[model samples]
Target chain A: MIASAYAVPSVLVFVTSALLILIGALGVISVRNPVHAALCLIMTLFGVAVAFVAQSADFLAAVQIIVYAGAIVVLFLFVIMFLGVDQRAHIHFEPLVGQRAFAGVGVAITVAGLIALMARSHWVTGAVSVSSKLSNGSGNVKELGTAVFTTYLFAFEATSALLVIAVVGAVLLARRERSTTSEEAPQ
Target chain B: MNVPAAWYLVLAALLFGIGAFGLLTRRSALIMFMCIELMLNAVNLTFVTFARTLSDISGQAIVFFVMVVAAAEVTVGLGIVVSVFRRRSSTSVDELSEMKG
Candidate 1:
């Protein structure tokens, strides 16, 4: 079938999420203020969470909301406010001549190529699932937990190490040290 | 009938393209970081769709890990940005030309 008719609810959900995502994405880049961009980021993230729900990725949808929209966007706003760079700066002042035009063309080409490949090839060929069948609906959390703790046990443990390292690195990088010499002062 | 995977795929591609364009064109390091987040979400959407198609839970598990990694990356990345902003009052990449070779 060239195109299949879909359920009304599903189509509506998809359309809603797509609109939120695209409009918010455009807002992010087009907006001059970093604060506005961060707000746009939250809108885009909520749209992603909606899509996740439509796809039966219930857990991810929740995580997407909590982790992405809640935590991540807040962190971005914190940085923005802390830096006091919340003014509405000019968005069209391109450092490189025609940089926006070139970027737009390049991205259009890449997205077109991606869609073409998907259309032509036997796209996203399904392999025999090793983990449990994505157990649907309310069971997602259990299934996800089991998979993380069992099949991906090592990877799960390694994430802890990664998080620790990241925290230490962030603290080290963000820490301010008063310079002993005038030359070392932030000039 | 339900929405096809192709539809979702196309949407993800568009999302990714938008993110890439923003990354390429945006001058602010903070805005660029937000664009990167958009790209990551697009990839995550694709992963979740494939997880449904393949009936595999591993994809969701992988998304979990991806979120963790993304969090870590943002933590370190923002720290660097803050430190850089401390030295240079501006967040615009155009101003930081000292490393240009």
Candidate 2:
């Protein structure tokens, strides 16, 4: 996996993915239009997929692309288009005084904790051997499927039900229904 | 030199920070959605890194499920955003505060 002194494939992949993720995040926040924001999100998704590939999770990378970048982002775009919301509308920027302060403090504490954890821990570096039972490199898909069907079947089914509920709720919310009741007198 | 796990973690942290900053500063609902995606990507990177470091397929499998859920979330979230826009004609989160007293 190592190449020239200055350039390694892994390093290249990591740097590129990291850069794209950072740019996409910045774009998401800085962009004014929802459509553009969704597009930026696509970029971020793509970057993560690349990172997955770099980690030797080829199947996961493919799934990441197909699901998150392809289906999810497209859905987001469809909704943004259907909404027809004005992109140039005036927006208020006043921060909530208490919430903002609280959020800042919370983030600071989390960051400090994470830094301390990183500093205290000794990370081991080596080639990890795969389990003999799962040595075929069918990757996570086979293992996950086995786990899901065998041990976590109930949880999987529950998740499916939850997804169904979400879909039904989304449909109900998005549908435009005609008013059937008499209108109230104008105020 | 080969890419280290630390590099990936640092990148993920940077991306997460950017997402947080965007979430805090942006008034557009669309931008907020994008920031959420950014956060999700950060998590994805962590999953991939762990899978590689451990040489296990389970991390990749977790990434697979995450991708599926992320897709579903985006679809439903966008649908909500569209409906909200249709009702108000605006996508700015600040202006959509109907519960504000």
Candidate 3:
């Protein structure tokens, strides 16, 4: 990388995003109201977008806002309103004994292991610009678009099929009446 | 121009850990779904970090696919949630453990 530390502005950006992410994540879990949780989720997504911009992923940042905050969270809110499950859950009820304790322990261990692994890896050759130099500014969108169209063309096309399948499957699953045997037999 | 990749990596790790905790501890299916999205974002952040570090555009491309897949997954997953809610008026995972043979 350039150095052990970056510009003060960059560091501030990182700190701000990190705060947004952690606080929003905590809010998502601890908040009893599902609707509030969804709002908090938007905060987390925006935070990730900020981090994306900090890393020069301006295109992804835009997609993050447009797709995630724009579409997905709205879908979540729609489902919550449609089902009327928007009320607060009973967070104090421990139906499963010691579940939170065990989960906390496991997640802590996993995070520590991941951090240690990253530290020991030989990724010290960081930012060598091996493939395409990610020159910031106007080049980001062009670079990402070219990669999606050229190298990942097949996968990109496959996603269209996947989206269609998901749509069909969602309709089938959420239909008001289940025919059981055949769709044509139903009134 | 940017921070060290390691900083981003560590941040993502913490994000993943938080998501994992929420997924495990939260019994509400909707909240669990949100946690899964949280974890997915963490991984996407990592991909973007590497995309910058290696100066490889492919990492960003993969993130694009991941986003598409995530959207599709949520669509189907929420449909299943709606159907399940239709059968039982509650959204808690504790009530859906009937298949534990």
Please report the candidate that would top DockQ against the real structure. Answer: 1
Candidate 2, position B89, lDDT: 76
Please list all clashing residue pairs in model 2, or write none if there are none: none
lDDT of each: 0.88, 0.67, 0.89
Chain A TM-scores for all candidates read 0.88, 0.73, 0.87
What is the C-alpha local distance difference test score of candidate 3? Answer: 0.89
Q: What is the C-alpha RMSD of each candidate to the true structure, in Å?
A: 3.3, 4.7, 3.0
Docking outcome class, model 3: medium
- What candidate 2 gets wrong by more than 4 Å, as runs, is A1-7, A89-116, A123-141, A179-187, B98-101
Across A1-187, the per-residue lDDT of candidate 3 in tens digits comes to: 3334567788889999999998999999999999999999999999999999888788899999999999999999999999995564688788889999999999999999888877889543555555556675543888888878887889999999999999999999898875665767765
How do the residues A1-187 of candidate 2 rate in per-residue lDDT, one tens digit apiece?
A: 2455435766777778877877877777666667777878878878887877666666777777887777777777776676664466433345575555565566566655654565466432444644312334344556656755755566567667767877887887676654323243342
Residue A108 in model 2: shift from native, Å? 6.3
Sorted on TM-score, highest at the top, how do the candidates line up?
1, 3, 2
Query: Which run of 10 residues does model 3 chain B get worst, by summed lDDT?
Result: B92-101
Candidate 1 lDDT over residue span A55-135, tens digit each: 888888999999998888999999998899646456777768999899999999999999999889755785747678876
Per-model i-RMS: 1.1, 3.7, 1.7
Q: Assess candidate 3 and give its TM-score to the true structure.
A: 0.92
lDDT of 2 at A1: 25
What's the true lDDT of residue A13 in model 2?
A: 77
Give the 10-residue window scoring lowest on summed lDDT in candidate 3 chain A.
A122-131
